[model samples]
Target: MATESAAPSPFEDQVLAHLRNAEAAYHAEQRERARELDELEATRAALAESQTHARLLTAELDAQRWNAERERQRVECLKQAMREIHGALFHGDVYTLILRACLTISGATRGIYVTCTRPDGPLRVRAHIDIPAIQGAAPPPMVAQLCRDVLAKNDTIVCSEADTAARLSGDEPQGLRFRNCVAAPVVLLANLDGVVLAADKMDGEFDDRDIEALLSVGDQATVAVRNRHLERELQTAYVHTVTMLADAVEAKDPYTHGHCEMASRYARLVASRLGLSEHDQALVCYSALLHDVGKIGVSDGVLNKPGPLLPEEVELMRAHVRVGYDLLNHVPALRDVADVVLRHHEHYDGGGYPDGMRGEDIPMPARIVSVADAYCAMITRRSYKDAYPEAAARAELRRCAGTQFDPVVVDAFLAILDTPEALDGDSDDFAECGLLPGFEAMRAQASPV
Candidate 1:
């Protein structure tokens, strides 16, 4: 049935619109919340990643610092080792420093430095550390062979326990000595050959570090030894050159042909008897040899005068001391010896040529030369005076002791003269040194000048 048409109510329409708006606002709020949540998650992940990278960077920095410290320590250790090796003065000192440094660096339980002057000779152990004492003991068979091998190849070797065992024969016992070793050759000179070996590390097997250490030590030792060898050669050459110059001075006069040699021997013996050190004895001996060197500057007329010298002539003869001192002082190496040379003619009681330094003022070496020089003069024959008998010479020494020479030195020389074959042995020594052709006849002559 159709009824009259009904119009829509305003309240219903307004309510429906409000509900639609509310639903739309709820959906928009949900979408905005989701976007905020997504942004939060991304920020958290970025924070986590940054923190992880920071941790890794921190670790790397720590590693770098640790490595730097280790390298610094290594360099410092090497410097100290160089000091020890280079400071050494003699061959034995160098050998000891090398072995000790090796043992310390490698932490070896046993170590040895073996060398030989001749290629074919057996290895001689120059230095060792932590070795059980065995009388007349030689190196173990394997070690000897290893040293020879190292010497031949000039190689640096790092051997493990297995390698050590393999080097031995199959029949040999297991777990033998020298289970691990670091060995290197010390090769520098043609005449010298050596091997430095460190064995049985306390903590671990031999490694590259140990081999490097051994090689470094061997290199240091080689350099030090080479320096000492060169120094010795230079010193020998200098001695020969000076001795020849002194010899030239003597060659000018036949009467004084061997005067310097005789004086040198006497001075050495007297210096030793006086308890002087070997170094001091050498200085005195050399000074005595060159005491008359300046006599070459004197004219032949005055030098070979058959009678006593006039006042002026005596002054000229005495000037030889100053001339010798000046000649020696010009050489830098002889400056110290020149000091002694200048004072050799000084008398104990102050009556002498040159500066006339008296008593204890004279250098001990020069004082020693004085006694030796006077003694030689008393026993030697000259154109002006005959050689005094030994008894007369001794008496003259005693009479002139306090006045012209140091009494203590004179007493020491007198004691040496009292040895059983002392005076008799002089003849053989004189002949050996190419002294005047007839020393026996010279000793048989009359009074001293």
Candidate 2:
């Protein structure tokens, strides 16, 4: 066997070695290619994961931005509502201001405000805003009831199509229909003052955000209403004080017992007949009541004397107008009426003392007070002169219309007395006041041809 194993070919052995080396190199190349492919796959997978993460972050960022925008808008609406409420408080038109502010904040088409003096009292409609048509129409029963529920609960109610049918199943509005609504209670502590309602959203359906906004407005409205009540109380106290002062002045003279009251009544009537505004009418009445307030500064000797005043006494009596001006001008609240008091004696024909303002130069309130004072004085039984008869007083007023009184004011005063029932009750008092029957005929007789 050793002999037979003779000499294997060296070439064959080398070829075999070469073949083995080539096979090994091919396997190594295949392994390298597989590794490269595996690396490429891993890189692609990592890149895909990064892209997905970036997309997720972008979506989250957009959501955050949207939320921030909504929050900003909500804050802006609240700020605007606060500003409007402050303006309303200052202007003393709380109902209108609150309703308008609520409408702006909620973007509602219509709004209604209601209040009650007592908890069990009937509701009073304070203000309303309806588009296009309808002025101050009463709220629907359902809406009113919903407002009541809000008050009872001391919270806000939001009604959409989802709940409106269930909440107001059997009720319907009279003129308009609503698809969405919101109501809030205006409360201070445990006391429910009123309710505020908003309906028919302009943008979309009302939601919880709207409720929150309205509740905020409701709180401000409650504050405004409270302030209004306080202001009214203060005004009443001030008026009472002023009236007492006027009474004291009138008490100094026995003949002028009812002079201030009569003059104020007559001035108010004339102002109403002249179609003056409510504020102006009040001004005229108050000024007439206080027109003789300066008499306090005059000497009692001249004021209470039963005889005609001497020239010097008359001069002293005339000085009262200036004194009253000085006294009232110091009070900020009464300063506006002070000018009217000072000019009340000024004649339309430029013959009166103090200013001699002629015709329209006189303030309308002063002119009105002057006419009322003159008529009251003429009809009053004074220490120096008997009271003029009704007819005689009317004739005298007509005779001196342009000379001592404003003709326009005279006409208006006469017209006020011309009503059928103007002198209906208490013939004695009417006669004493010189408000005679047949005033229309008297005015006709006094009219220039």
Candidate 3:
């Protein structure tokens, strides 16, 4: 132990050093290989991440394309709907076209077109899709609130789940548990006219595109409504003009100043008794008032003549119907009334008239007017005749029911005479005239027939 365990010789020491160098070199190489392996593993990980990122980008781009295509299709559908609205005949038809476009763009399950002159009052459900709306009944609380809110804000509003749940008022209509809503308000004549609102989007909550679509459709619908309003105004003006013309003819003849006015009441009463529709009733009444308007075109000599006229003079007198027809034929609202005016002189037996139309050949409105006019003329004092007694007028009306007048019209007129108002013509109740019919009287239909 004491002798330093034998000091190695130089050659042996050199050999040991060489062996130690080799072992050291081997360990260093192993460390280098470990470092290389770590770098390879890191590179593989980076490559995987890049591939994943690429896939994500590709997927996002694809999704965007799909959405773009959907939007394109939606816009096209809306465009087509807009074109269809141009052909809409009624306000109801216009509303329907707007709703269909909304459904197409928003994926809504149901749609409604509501209007109210006041925001606080009950809303009128003019048109609907898939909702059994009772038109005049109370609207669903949710829908009512949506419309009210839209009106108050004067802007479009979108109600998602939470909003619908909180803002919902009383019991909604069955199956009206809306998860989402979109309300587009339409302003007209400087007032809040109404709202076009949709509910229950099927796919998801309403987004920007849905709101935009609704606004576009609302604007289109507003145009249609405004057009209808203008048409109504024009129609009213035309009717007023007709009234003036009737008055002018009456002014020319002292005895006929109130003749046309009285005859109209009789015609309307007869129409009502016969169960004619409001439009038909209005037709008969208007025809009666304007039946003699064409006489304005006749020479004053013929109109003031106290005796029977020659053949040529009579021909001139019969031309009054043609004149009246020409005047009204150009106005679309009065076209139907014109038919009555032109044919009112036709006899029930085909013996009297310029057209020789008989029996059912004459329009029913004209038939009614013929009976009312004859009776009224019989009872009134004319330039050429004396006023007939009430009994005599009644007898005369009965005498010509089948030959000169529509028998059914004569019977209906006599039956409703429980009071003397039919002959008095004193009441100013022009209530049944429907000067601006609710799509019935003075209807301004623009759709292509």
Best by lDDT: 3
Residues 1-449, candidate 3, lDDT per residue (tens digit)?
Answer: 47557789999999999999999999999999999999999999999999999999999999899899989999788888887765453334666777788888888888888887766766888778886676655567767777888877878898777787777454665555567778887665566667877888888788888888887776666666676677667766867777788878987777787788788888888888888977788788788888888788888888878889999999999999999888877776677777888999999999878799999988899998888788778888887889999789888889998999888988898886655666565645344466533334333443435
Residue 55: error of model 3 in Å?
2.3
| Model 1 lDDT tens row, 1-449 | 88987776898899999999999999999999999999999999999999999999999999899657745665576668767676553323667677777777777877888876554567777677764323234555666778777766767777888888877766443434566888877655444467778888888676676677666665556667776576457555656656776877877766787777777777777888888865576677677777887787888888889999999999999988878888877755455567777888899999976986799988898988898888878889987889989789989989999999999989988787766534443533322222111212222332134
What are the per-residue Cα lDDT tens digits for candidate 2 across 84-116?
Answer: 655443234667787887777777888788775
Question: Each candidate: how many clashes?
Answer: 0, 0, 0
The lowest-lDDT stretch of 10 consecutive residues in candidate 3 is 436-445
In Å, residue 235's CA in model 3 sits off its true spot by 2.0
Q: What lDDT does the true structure give each of the candidates? A: 0.72, 0.73, 0.78
TM-score, per-candidate, Cα-based: 0.64, 0.67, 0.66
Off by over 4 Å in 2: 1-84, 89-92, 116-124, 130-144, 160-177, 187-192, 219-226, 269-279, 298-301, 355-361, 419-449
- Structural RMSD, model 2: 10.8
Query: What's the true lDDT of residue 23 in model 1?
Result: 97
Error of 3 at 133 (Å): 4.7
Candidate RMSDs in Å, in order, are 12.5, 10.8, 6.7
Runs off by more than 4 Å, candidate 1: 1-78, 89-96, 108-145, 157-182, 187-193, 198-207, 219-226, 418-449
Candidate 1 clashes between residue pairs 3 or more apart in a chain or in different chains: none
Per-residue error for 343 in candidate 2, Å, reads: 1.7
